[model samples]
Target: MDEFAALTERNRQLSKAMMQSVFELACDLSGLGPFPEQAAKARGTAPVNARLMQIQQLIEQLRADLQGLRGPYLMQQLQGLGVDQHSRALQLHIGSGPYVLDGWINLDVFPAQLSTNVLWGLPFVDGQCRYVFLSHLLEHLFYPTDAMALLQDIHRILEPGGVVRIVVPDIAQCIAAYQDGDTGFFRDRVEHWGAGDGQATRLEHFLAYAGAGPDPAWLFEAHKFGYDQETLIRALQRAGFKTILPSTYMASTHSALRVDEHSQIASAKHGDRHYSLFIEAIKE
Candidate 1:
């Protein structure tokens, strides 16, 4: 791997380790079973306690180091892309997984040749980008605070009157389906997308459809939170976006803001269209 890729991998490893350590600390403090035996053995020892504190301090330092690396790393990526910060015509697709547009910079967190992690912040001067697009990307973030921060970042990078199109799974539609006794719609369409083999039980299906799963990777891919129209509008307004309006698949108020049909359809199964909510907001 290249230097940037190697650093990114190392950062990811450190983040995972930090999370595990935090969980263990919680378990230890709570007197919960399944705490590491090593931790249990070292619990009452002064030297071990001092070492644990040192390790935590080291982790905090490493996290700060990683944060410092992000800006320069993203600037390098932009340089490689031949992107100019002064260019007013720059458009971006954030969290753009395998969705390439001819005239836009497509970015994602995954390790890909074309994708870059956008969580660091947009690699542009304020008001440099004319348009931004992200579809079904917000729900993966585990915190609403992070989501709002990202939206505000996007707003900061966008030019005056620049539009951002967002699409997310409609939580309202999911609730309606559940209430209307169309559980199969949620089960078959959202959870599993294959011929019925009767593999999962009803409870398992419901949990999976609701974005709860046992797999560790699900923490990254599964929906952490859901939003209805009003909630999304409020978030946009909070992010300094005015003129927020509802939209539909492949449709927008301006022709220039049209959704990429290839990307949109490729992201969904046959009957999954109705489950998505599309909205556009302008930075004014």
Candidate 2:
């Protein structure tokens, strides 16, 4: 393993050990919480149990916070104006890989208006953006952790009634096609993007670019997770978004958020559906 990922894994191991120790402490304290007289504890005079519960809650929060950490390898790439509290443009195109918009800020790892890693967290203050769009970016981040962190951070930065549009590969459709032995779907998916060998089987084409090998750089660009319409909408709801809906290619209500990958648009132009799941959520 590389130095950075090795350090991260070691840190997580250490943290899990520490958390287990802390949870044991909490459990031990619970037995003594009502000691020296259960009456006083019942009357709220002895607040040991209450205090223990608070500590446990804090521990859970800290565990979640651990996922927010970014190794220096990734953190050093965070460049440009950190937090644009004064940016008048209300639209943000995060992870904009050549889908740069006219008025919105194009943010990516290479070169854009804001070249930084979103995994660390968004640099903008709360309610700074009216519309946020990220195409094929969520799947790149680790699911239920980095992905959720970014979604929650996006929700925090979006203004009330603001919108967040997410576009990702439709794993649901891929699985359906595989189960039905629909070679045409898999063939079209691979050919539409010209990203993989068209002759590959459904399973192979589905996971085509999931890291060329164990190399850290390749893994960094690979799809770490997949999501369907239901799971994605549920995640958005958990992020505190009020209204969530499944959308279509280039059919977003907001003109600024309609920008999508050309492959998705072209595939949809010829067929009723493509291998992209488009979903939108409104922060309220």
Tell me the whole-model lDDT of each prediction, alpha carbons only: 0.72, 0.73
Q: How far is candidate 2 from the true structure (C-alpha RMSD, Å)?
A: 10.9
Q: In model 2, which runs have C-alpha deviations exceeding 4 angstroms?
A: 1-83, 195-198, 208-217, 261-270
Worst 10 residues of 2 by lDDT: 209-218
Write down the lDDT that model 1 would get. 0.72
Best prediction by TM-score: 1
Misplaced by over 4 Å in model 1 are 1-21, 32-44, 47-49, 112-116, 190-218, 264-273
